[model samples]
Target: MRTTHAHPIAAALAGLALLATLSGCAGSTAARSDAAAGGPAAPVPAAAGAAAADEKAASTSEGTAYAAPGASERQLARTAKLTLVIPDPAKAAKELRGVAEGLGGYLLNENVVTEQKDGYYVEPSTVTVAVPGTKLDDALDALSKIGEVRNRNVGSVDVTTDMVDLEARIASLRASIARVQGLMDKAGTITEIAQVEKELTSRQSELESMLSKQKALAGRVAMAPVTVTLRPPSVVIQDPNPLWQGLTAGWAGLLQSLRMLLTIAGALLPFVVLGVLIWLPIRVWRRRRRPNAPGLLASVLAPATVDAEDVPAAKPLDAPRDRPTTVDG
Candidate 1:
C-alpha cells in the first residue's frame, strides 16, 4: 500500500465523466424502448383481438342475412290453360270432370250444351275444370282417355329473386336489430343510446316490410292454378232413314238455292233494265254516225302515191330525174 502510485485528479475526473455519459446513453435507450411499447401509434394486442372478433361477427351476420329462400323457389312450378276438343262435347265434359276428380282436382266450371241435329241428337257440350298444378299431368293423362288433347299451354313467371332477396334482407335486418339492441343496452351515454334506438326503429320497420313481402311470396308459391277445358267425345250416329233425310235435305237445299237465285235475279233486274236503257241511245247514235257505203270504184280507190306511180309513171319519173328545177316530183 505504501508503494502504490496515486492517479492524477484530472484523469480521475475524465474517467468519471465518460462513465456518466455511457450511463446516460443506456438510460435513454431504455426509456425509448418503454415509450415505444406504450406509444399511441403502437398496435394494442387487446384491441386487435376485439377487432378480429367484431370482424368475425360482421361476417357471420352478413352470411346469415344474404341467404336465399329455400327449395320451393328453386323448384319453380306453374300451370296454364289446357284445351281439349272431342267430337261429342257432353260425353267429353263428363270424362273431363271424372279425370279432374281422379287427378286430385275439382271441376271449377262446368258447361254442357247438347246441340241437336235436326232436333234429334245431341251435337256436343263443353266442360271447364280447375285442377291442381301438381296433378295437371295426371288429369291430362286421364283426359286423354276421354278425348284428344287439341291444345296444351304451360307458363311460369320468376319471382324467386325478389323473394330470396327479401328473405335475406329480413334475416339481416333482424340480426342487425338485435345487435343494435345489445349496443343500446351497453351504451352508457345518452347520445349513444339515442343513436342506437333510432337505428333499431329503422331496422324494425324494414323487418316488418320484409316480412309482409315474404308472406305475399309464400301465398303465391303455396298454391298453383290450373285451367282445363274438356271437349266431348266423337260419336257417329247412323240413321236407317238416311236416304229419306238426304232427299229431304237435298230438296230443301235445292229450293233454297232456287229462291236465292230468283232473289238475286230480281235484285239485278232493275239494274239490267237501266243498263239496257242507257245503251240504247248510245247504240242509236253510233249507228246514225256510220257512213253509207260508197260506189264500188270509190270504195276500191288506190292511195294517191300508188295512183300517181301507176298513171304514166315512166314519163314522170324520167322528167323528175332530168329536170329537178322544173317541178317537185
Candidate 2:
C-alpha cells in the first residue's frame, strides 16, 4: 500500500512538471515569432519616457506646421487684368457681357467712354467680370478673340495650406466646444457650470469666426475676377481726300482756337472788370483836374504832345536882325 501511494505521488509530480515545461516552451515560441515579425521587444521604459516621446512628436509636428506638399486638391485664387485693342469697344463690351451671362457669369461693373480720334469718336470700355473658377480659362480664351491683346497679366495665389490649417483649427475648436458643453451638462455646482459655459461660448465664437473665414476663402477659390480694358486700335484710318482732310483740319483748328480764345477771355474778364471799377473814378478825377480831357476813344488813339521846354527854342531872331542892321548901316 505504501509503494502504490509513493508511485502515484511521483507520477503526479512528473505530470505537473511536464505541463509547466510545455507552457514555458509555448510562451517562448510566441515571443520569438513576435520578435521576428515585429522588431525585437524592447524592455518597457518608465511612463515618463513615453510621455516625453509623445511631447516631442507633438512639438515637432506643430513646429513643422501644415503644408500642401504636391497634393491633388490644390486651392488657387486666380485673377487677371487685361488690356486689348478691339475694332469697336462698345460692340465688344456687349459681346463680352453676353458671353459672361452665357457662362453663368456676370459683369460686376462696366464703363464706356468715347474719345476723339482721327476726327471720329472711338469708344473704349472697361468691364469687370466675375466668373466661376472652372470657366475662367474659357472666358479668357473667348475674350481674347475679340481684340488684339495689348497687355495681359494673369496671377494665381496658393491657399492650400491656409485652407487646410483653417479647417483643422475649426474642427479642433468645435470639438473643444462639444467637450465643454458636455462638462457643463455634467457639472455638479453652479460655479463649474458657469466656467464650462464661458469656455464653451469662447470656443463657439472662435469656431464661428473660423467658419466665416473659411467661407470667404472658399468664395475666392470658387470664383475668379477679371478686369478687361478694351481700347481702340492703335492705328486709325484717315480720309484720303485732301479737301475733306483739309476741311476737317480747318474746322478742328478753328474750334480749338475759339476754345482757347474763350478760355483767355473768361480768365481776363474778372481782372478787366476789377480794373474798370478801380480806374473809372481815378479817370474821372484826372479829367476834372485837366478840365480839357478827350473822350476815352480819343485818349486811347491821341499822340502825346511835347512840352515847350522839351522842344529846343528858336533863337531871338528879331534881336539878331536889329543888331545886324545897325552894323550894316
Please list the C-alpha lDDT of all candidates, in the order they appear: 0.55, 0.64
lDDT of 1 by residue, 66-153 (tens): 3435537463445566676666666666776777776666776666777666544353344566566566566656766665667777
Candidate 2, residue 137: the lDDT equals 89
lDDT value, residue 214 of candidate 1: 67
Q: Write candidate 2's Cα lDDT for 183-214 as tens digits.
A: 44345555545555666576567667766777
Measured against the true structure, the TM-scores of the candidates, in listed sequence, are 0.36, 0.50
- Candidate 1 least-lDDT 10 residues: 1-10
In candidate 1, which residue ranges exceed 4 Å CA deviation?
Answer: 1-73, 86-134, 143-147, 183-202, 218-222, 230-329
| CA-RMSD of model 2 | 20.2
The number of clashing residue pairs in each candidate reads 5, 0
Q: How well does model 1 score by local distance difference test?
A: 0.55
Error of model 2, residue 198, in angstroms: 2.3
